[model samples]
Target: MSFGFFNIPAPVNEPVKEYRPGSPEREAVKQAIATFRSQEADIPMYIGNEEIRTNQKVRLAPPHDHQHTLGYFHEGTAEHVNKAINAALSAKDAWAALPWEHRANIFLKAADLLAGPYRARINAATMLGQSKNAYQAEIDSACELIDFLRFNAKYMAEIYAQQPNSASGVWNRLEYRPLEGFVFALTPFNFTAIAGNLPAAPAMLGNTIVWKPAYTQVLSANVFMEVLKEAGLPDGVINLIYVDGPVAGDIIFNHADFAGIHFTGSTKVFQTIWGEIGANIHKYKSYPRIVGETGGKDFVLVHETADADEVAVGLVRGAFEYQGQKCSAASRAYIPSNLWSAVESKVKQFLSEVKMGGVEDFTNFVNAVIDERAFKKISAYIDEAKKSDQVEIVAGGNYDGSKGYFIEPTVIKVQDPAYRTMCEEIFGPVLSVYVYEPSYFDSIIKTVDQTSEYALTGSIFAKDRYIIERVSKALENAAGNFYINDKPTGAVVGQQPFGGARASGTNDKAGSALNLYRWLSARTIKETYVPPRHFGYPFLEAE
Candidate 1:
């Protein structure tokens, strides 16, 4: 095939299916879930073209119904991580040397595969394996994942289109090079889209990858891998392994070929990974590029002039969707005292109407937390609130973990805004509301800006244009994906380039051109058409 300038299909956000009654998507997903529940899958670690199954295994169950066995996955050791690392390195040269178009084609094809034939199965796996309801799974596993793949391809083309301007008698060209060594993509359990993007983003830029998905997310991750494999992704270009974080870290961190890591998880884990890389800096062939997006104590600040209904709906949806597993989920809110009453009443009313259960039941608005650890951690906070006079559990403080890790949509009204629940990243469906005097809006903005180390996502609601402008400017650095009047959650790909700074992460702005830049290094080439025969003649004559 003759090489020529290639243009990727213009990227657009994948339309999220409503999965409403009698909808094709609804019935298809229901059938997919039913098909999945009838069997157990034994997933293995992928290295090159091989699937390696270890003696030890990790049993998998849905967070919404822990009693039901969905499947189990092979658990690998440090040796396996080493093998995956070796596999990535073995294919790095040929893979990176392949034309950029070919590389992008694989991901584009994979996106189409997911958007079409593989959509139902992927969504079903996410629902059964991760406890996400139909809508959440549709947005994450189906829509957002497709968006990442499609947009990343377009962004890759955009990056390659950038070139240096040339002067007379000189021609200048720039080339984007894949990282010299392998990239390790450490993905989280919250979003399967992120689980796919973290690795695929790096791989799309022609870097080979060793991906270690969160154990709780392996089922969906495996399906994602299958999609890529079927899309004609070359063998050994991207290896998948299921192993302990430390086991993988010990081997990967110290390896001489360790190039970089693409991470999305908790702040503590990202910190540990960063520290290990720093500790092993001397052992690596080059400085490893560390790109990560971590935890957030995200907030929503409502003004006196804000729409009461919108504020209420925003709080309920932002703080409780997917059981608030989103890193960008709103955990803290500052509502004007005048609006608090209406917002609280509406929020309570919404919660009263919300049904919590397995995702198989389409009527359920909220599902289970990822596991018991999350349930206990969140419930402990709620329990402390119940015991304290400083805060009131305004709504839904109940929890039932006998069958699954379920916590009702909880809202605690705190007198002290600095309370732990207000400042900390709960990573659950718990929102801490603090009603503030309208005159103290500016003061509270400053407080919200400085309250937590995180600045992932936050929202501002105000009908007053002055208030909107003032608050937006005041909380400028408060969030990466700042919302005008909408909820803090649901940062769409392409349109809202996601990420944040400080404790939140490196803020690489995934789903855009910026994130792709991380996996590549650039080389500038300048060719002089006319060369001076004598090196110093022009300067000497002029002088």
Candidate 2:
């Protein structure tokens, strides 16, 4: 099939012209890099209270032509993680003892740092390092962090200071306190917002944390730490380590002071961690909180009466944005057969307009996949889907890894919702569109719900209120954050508590009040002016 989707334009790769830094033609690039270098030169990585450097050189994204030069980070050794955790545990008590207002001020200052040129610098770095286009890079990096900083601090502060109810005759008040030990934050690479949420919420509530960002996005995570330090976040309140996952897991999971984990990644990893926590539940001083947002088999349900153009917009952005790397990216779309032609036409038109190229190019819409491994995975899925006799390639399904890790924004029409593409979390720019008979609407909806082990997010496009209500109620358990006529990937903080229950996640609710709750433990204190005048038991009264 041709790469073009309806009227959507194929990615036009107008190459960037090379020029010397000081040349007139290169002035903008020179300025951007200068701003980038100034902000990034002293970026700190907090290993507990200490800001340590490993002499590791941060590299920009290798040339698009140099596909063989895979970027790798200098991993934090096991010993390093142990030391960091020890420091976090040590600082927990003193950090937690600080007044809420003091902690809030630190976060607010950090927010200020995040909003300034520091954010732009970090965004530029993320763009160059991850090979993300201008919009994709900025959206996932700086903008999301701004959202997190503004909302999370305000929410946590408000909740922490909320007053307890007082009875007229009997005096009673409740107090919230931080959990006693260091928490672990394991984040993913897709969004910088996850980076902020995984650590800051807990830290805001007076809980110290050890954060291990995903290897693919370490540079952005490093930038975040630097911003935090500049904002005057106290040393040891949050720590960062660059270690292998299993090694970090061992250090954090087995430690005596390990109190909780905030994770966002694969379901298998989450289950493994959960199982380990179960095995060692008795070994811990107390129960440790495990919060995660795992894999998603997110879907977009299109009804017969839905707006075709609206659905098209949602599909294009939801399925192909970020190369469909997001957990909530719409992978499987269920459409009523009656409107299949119109919806398919519109989606095809939308896909054709998507332009993919280099991050530095302002006009490019999409860019490279994170790495070769991910690009290959997406290619394999497309190959598998193409081989099936039960599917048809509607628009695009192609990959050219000779240069950058690029894949066409793919679209496929499947005959059965039970097909592998429909059921699995492709986690790439491969959209599987399934047309269903009107009679099988309810049955198909049920089928879609059970298609995957995950239910992180889903959306429906329908103008009919009754239909919207019915489909929504039906897919209630299918997703944590459900949408109507809107893309699922962009979840606003405070308004939508982001995460899922069951296989999708551990119900951490990242952007909401519930996320802050995970960082604290409740303690009850009661006072009485007079002792019990008379005991119910005779022995007590005598005493």
Candidate 3:
């Protein structure tokens, strides 16, 4: 059916729009936000070509302004999950049989749509729904998502171009086939880019998907589905549903057609899903591929030679941005005693200047966390630290949830290196600092490595080249995405290729060709131009 090789457009990162004062983008986004706030959206689950609405409507609201209603989404039951699975299965064969270039083009068009017409709307939704500031929403929903779509299309082409070598009179070829059954994409609430990528990545590779997004992220997720539909994505390719996790998992994992799952969430939930899959392994046609990026106790290690100003900036930006909800956020720091005084001073000053409020207020650097649950979990850590004699709350331990789930960007100085806050993943704007003696640098590196079970990301600040090399080698296994002088968060698509190993994730490197490989099952074909007349080999007879 195809004549010649097709090349996709060269992939490039989308330019992030800075919503500076007096800019058109700022006004556009502000207007978009106001427009969204004006309407009461009645969202429904998208299954196949139908928008299914049920009696159980869950109310949605912004985290900062909980009393104000945004809209409501129709929640689904186990039967709806079954319907989604059936829809995905029904469309799987046709979707996979479609030419690779067509599939690539669909996603490419979606990327352009997001980058141009739909940018402001999607960013505004993420800001209101996920409690992110304007800049954070732009980088996540607009720029990073565009990068994923564009780069993933290029990666798909590269994957298909790989061929096998032949010897003598034999010709060999390799065909990359989609997984036999449908893929389940369980997306997170933190980043809109991730929510889009989890399902789009596999679907781009010609696999139909059953996408279940976090309830908090449905507003932006719905906008993404609209983009895909407008880009000519066929019905039933990616069925979006809002269902309870356990109920959906119970039916999906036990099904014979369940092929794989791409997940981004907590460690406990991932483990539980893995156990359920293992328990139901015999029911499936083939072993399901499980890929996930779970929790992170990410860290920052500052050397004595590191500049105090640079260290302070890294701490403030890395720890507090997006309310420290990023898996790669710097939750813990190991600062040398010599630089502690200066770093602490700068950190305190920065926190004092920071303002917390709603996303509509562009002057505010910090906004509310995702929900009340996260607020309670993070504030509990701060409360325990305040009560402990071994820990001193250097700056910001105040919190108020009456108007909104607001927690001040708090920093705790712990006497013990293995304090609860340092080891545990408190996914909020809380940073725990441990001042170590300069002589114990080697031991501190080991402590940092051994402190947390997660290996998602980390950064070390040092001016000395020798120390950098030594520390790099010594803590090689500590983090998958390690930085020298920069912060651990904000991994660019083509540049960084983010993911981690150990408890963090499969480390398949989502932004590169590596992640696309996971969705394909390769088949090798070998053909001989000339066949032997006899069954027996001449070499065997001669020997």
What are the Cα lDDT values of the candidates? 0.93, 0.76, 0.94
Cα error, candidate 2, residue 392 (Å): 1.1
- Least accurate stretch of 10 residues (summed lDDT) in model 1? 534-543
Candidate 3 lDDT (Cα, whole model)?
0.94
Quick one: how many clashes does candidate 1 have? 0
Order the candidates by TM-score, highest first — what do you get?
A: 3, 1, 2
| lDDT-better candidate, 2 vs 3 | 3
lDDT of 2: 0.76
Q: Judged by lDDT, which candidate is best?
A: 3
Give a tens-digit lDDT track for model 3, residues 206-325.
899999999999999999999999999999999999999999999999999999999999988999999999999999998999989998999999999999999999999999999999
Q: Which is superior by lDDT, 1 or 3?
A: 3
Model 1 RMSD vs true structure: 1.1
lDDT per residue for candidate 2 within 1-543, as digits (tens), equals 333212211212112233334554344433554454444344345776566666654433432333433243455678888888888877888888876767777776766675565656566667666666555655666656666666766676567566667665556765788886788999988787787778988888889888888766776777788778877777787888877889888877887678899899989999999999988887787799888889998899888778888888898999888788888899999888888888789877877877777666655667778777888888998998889898899988888888888888999998877888888777888889888887787787788788888888899898899989998888889899999989888776656778887688977787777778877788877667666776586665653
Q: Each candidate's root-mean-square deviation in Å?
A: 1.1, 9.5, 0.9
Candidate 1 per-residue lDDT, tens place, 165-208, comes to 99999999999998889999999998999999999998988899
TM-scores for all candidates: the values are 0.99, 0.89, 0.99
